[model samples]
Target: MLASVAAGLASTALGGAASAEGGGVPALQLITLTGPGTSGGDTGPGELLARQDAVLAKVGNPTTTYRWTTALNGFAVELTPEQVAVVESDPEVASVEANSVRPMSARRTPVPSSAQVRQPRATGGAGVVIGLVDSGLAPESPLFAGVPGLGRGPKDFAGSCEVGEDWPATTCNRKVVASGWWVAGFGPERIRSSEHLSPRDAVGHGTQVASVAAGNAGVSVRMRGRTIGEFGGIAPQARIAPYKACWGAPDPRDDGCATADLVSAIDRATADGVDVLDLAVAGPPGTDTVERALLGAAEADIVVVAAAGNDGREEYAAHGSPWVTTVGASLGSVWQGRVSVVGGPTLTGASRSRRTSPPTRLVLGADAAAPGATRRHAAQCRPGSLDAAATAGRAVYCERGGIGRIDKSEAVALADGVAMVLGNVRPGPVVDDFHAVPTVQLSAPDAQRLTRWVRSHDRTSIRMSGVAPSPVAGRTAAWSPSGDPRSSVIKPDVVAVGDGVLGAVPDQRGWAMFGGTSAAAARVAGAAALLRSRHDWRAPVVRSVLATTAVPLGTESVLRQGGGRAGADVRGARLALVVRTPRYREVLESGSWGDLNQSSVLVRATGSVTRRVTNLGSRAEYFSAQAIGFTRHRVRVTPLAARLSPGETATFRITVTGPSTPGHVDDGWIRWRGARGSVTRVPVAITR
Candidate 1:
């Protein structure tokens, strides 16, 4: 079945539920405030204190800073916009604007399945290079087994002495060249590790991602295999080149390697002649440095694919850059078809003190909910409350929080009343699983509407139709990045099946259920590898072919699905045979120019035809021709287009150009069709 594309929105009340942490409020940026004489003199400590007091009085006790350096010579104060205005209005104040503010994290929207693959076919990219830039990776992953021409082992970007399979160490390895490292508390620490330090994935994010890209199929390594953990990756046949970029703890503040390390990794991948490059990490939105590096890689013909980000917002600009294929997340089947709701009725108070209610009836609808019912105090069931609705057997609604909603929903389900929980947030609803109870998420607006309806009329009813429990096309998963509507570029071009994906981990343990765009990206990379094995094409060309061939999903238009879903079609991958003269060529080549061309060629299946035409141009070209007494049948073509770039050759099928024209002497020509076209004449001797 084809994948569909649609926006997934979370539906729930606004408050701590919707917030990331600290009472659900987003992190506030500490903006610095300066006053007119704040920087002029080398004031004594007493004077500094007096000045701070005066400023505080004017701004109603704004936070004051005494730390002064050459970089910041003025007395600094932190304040909100209202406070800043008051301080600026004071006669003593010079100027005030936000010096720093907390910006939104990078997010991505998942592309539909149509954008992922077009057809399923066995091609030859089985052994290709895929570069992984993330936390350390496990050296002995099953994905890398038996891969031919695998290069030298992983290189540590961060220096740490505890070389083999251990966590980061304080000691330094003088022999090991340190690229960069992030310490637990400090920023950018020096690394010191040696002794043939095999890549050790302490955090398992990198290892899990690599497994998705090239894990060996059906190979059980074993770790969290039974009871909530099983492992498998997308491309179980490709090889990987690991580059350790993320270090230290998972905290972003402590890790400050910046774009330098990422750029270096790209260069390294290109140098190694890697076929595919996977970047599961993301940076702040609007960061041009990362975009530039990705573009450079794309220009080099390296297929660049990146994670859209887990932030439930829009796709980050860096990932949306036209050069790279961004990936988003989607709920796996485990949560798609179920129903959920707030476990109990709302209550009145700060503490989430509430009583559990009896189980309610289940309602069928889209995964997301319509928003309604504000959380007054911590618990209080209003007439149309989500908890009340859930107690009646309907799906529960919740908001995105720092603590995973999945665990929370599971807890609610265990309470005996709730069936499932839907997570509401910026990108939309997500199915956060707490227990086996089926769950589906909805957008905030949708959840609100449902709440409003239930309140207005003692009971609420919702009926959902369309593909249920079916994979969505172009719908960003919780882990993929969201696209910026203001920017008008859909990121994370497509999504591959990644949730509950099984693959290898550390300690020879195999089969772990991993979720994230990294896994999906790996699957695509492995597929690309297979295509490469059949035909040698540049990275961009391969990406283009995949994009163009994809099938659209959902009721939405092309923007949602991009081109379509990804399919490994061995049949479609084979070049079509067509025969034509110069007249046909004129019609085929009338479009815009591109790096490749497609032509339809014709040949007598049972006759003595040993040679056929091959497209060597940069644009996709096509050729069409007719044959007498020849039937069409499938035949294997050499050097599939996936392996060829511009100036490369791959044998196509043979076709008879036209019927014998006695006076004019019939001749054959190849015509380009599809994205662009060109015509070429081939010498053929015809006898009546």
Candidate 2:
């Protein structure tokens, strides 16, 4: 990662011809200061800006772009190395961090079969406002159309729409109550022509995310003139405040949300009185400016939701802030297609495109390789690697990886291929994506079988059908990462459906299938909005309810699924780690992760941890506790049964004693069964 950053910096320097104008290359920096609420009195925006200006004046005032007074007591400005040194020395300055960029990175079941089932019960998040910090929104998409019964927009919302010649004033309505875009941190000169100046999505990322969170109900999802099915956001009636902080770049690495812009968006979203904040961008788990701003947002009673990441289980989790509800991605049964290899057994593959095509001759990508193109490159369907003559009238078989899924499809389409049989490198989640042609993605085993048949059999022909049962149902996605081992708190508070999620896109494309932890985060954010609207609960309470009420998807470890899939209904004890920490002064107390007041607990080997649970009901309830899934250790929960009145709280101790083995881990659930049939479960993890 460090080498890639260096390479990016070198490329930028060469491309922009930047030099040491103020002792180093120009860079964006987030300046944290000792401002309001840090000490005692509350400082207004004017006072905060004045304080920032005073500090900036000392450094010759490098261009200040974003002023963050609400969620953060700071501002984002572009400065050189010399200016940054002077600003860091200021007594009022708390910290200074160089701005970095992060790429933007769901669906069905586990959350309760479908969000459609929970909407009526939860009132569809009426009167709640969800703030999305992402790329941008596609205002023209039908998913954002104002519903007749949506009524007026939230009166507390302070966000506004930016109007321009291309972007009209009517972009935001009852559904999309507010919209804004930030690009100063990205450098206006770096904005591509395909990018929009308004809060309109050109990359389609933000559009897809928002659709999953709060798009209108019963919108028909379509792709390539084919009608798939009707789907809607979990909180269909919720208002959206879309803040465009990410932008697309020519280079994939450059396609990301800048730290300054992300901070700016979070600051404004908090000020806009959003009930929920949806952050679908991949970022660091550390408490940087963005994390600090998220903490402030939580302090302001906003439920913040973030994505775990798409880097898979090998990498640590992202957005590990205790205050935010980090969500991991899960893949469920997908709409698949049955492909019949004439004279061979039929196999099913995941596919969203239901278009019918005539039986076509099968062509191996290797056989169709263009002159001078490597066989491996041809197998992956590299752009310009397939010969037109060989691929023109055949169903091309392309391997996954080494290129974008859509790019491979485009390559096949460019070579006049009639259809595409896309195969994964290994057995994992098969994602459904928008393709340039009718495409079927097969698992590793099926792919290998089909490849062998295509090579050995002569006069091979294939027939495809959209009707086929999915291979797997409701499992953690292959790309969704696990918890951060460095932090004791089990990350990914819950896993939600993310693979093969249908959502809106920009332009005439209408809709596309999206997969990643980002989509899962959106679903969680929508669920949070529904819970907040129904019960008017605080952010922590909402988070606790979701985690405790969530049902386990499979026999996955705690690090992968945390508290398992997100649950829409609340029926659990609100658990908090009994941490003895100093009162929060200006920021949230960044103590041990075990100290966080969440539904999950993590204890080191042979240690006992205490937790407090509260009854969030109106009636008295008696609860019995039991521990399950613990092995190689003796675990005990004291005071097995507790009878408490409404809003009453009780404490319990979980003691563990066992031989500590290096790199060994033990995990289980501490479940409390309420007399009223409600059950609350908290995940407990022990590591040596």
In order of appearance, the predictions have TM-scores of 0.44, 0.78
Q: Give residue 611's error in model 2 in angstroms.
A: 1.6
**Top model number, TM-score:** 2
Question: lDDT per prediction?
Answer: 0.40, 0.76
The CA root-mean-square deviation of candidate 2, after full C-alpha superposition on the true structure, stands at 7.7
Task: Go through the candidates in order and give the clash count of each.
Answer: 162, 1
For residues 1-688, could you state the per-residue lDDT of candidate 2 as single tens digits? Answer: 1222233334344422223446577676789886432212366778877888899789765545567788878886667777788888999997799888887872222121112211223237788999999988888877788768664357567777765425677877888888777776675567677887667888788988898888888776665454546777878888898888898887645778888878878887887789999998767767788887887787677888999888884677787766778899876556677779888979888776666667888888878999999999999999999999999978899999899887898999899998899998887766666577788889999999998888788778999778744535456877788886557678888988876666778877676667788888888998888887777466777877878888786678888898888844653444322212112222344354554455788877888787888877788888899999988788889989899787778988888988887787788899988898888888988887
**For residues 257-329, could you state the per-residue lDDT of candidate 1 as single tens digits?**
2243344445445444456678776656642434444544554456777765555445442375545666554
Per-prediction CA RMSD (Å): 20.8, 7.7
RMSD score of candidate 1 (Å): 20.8
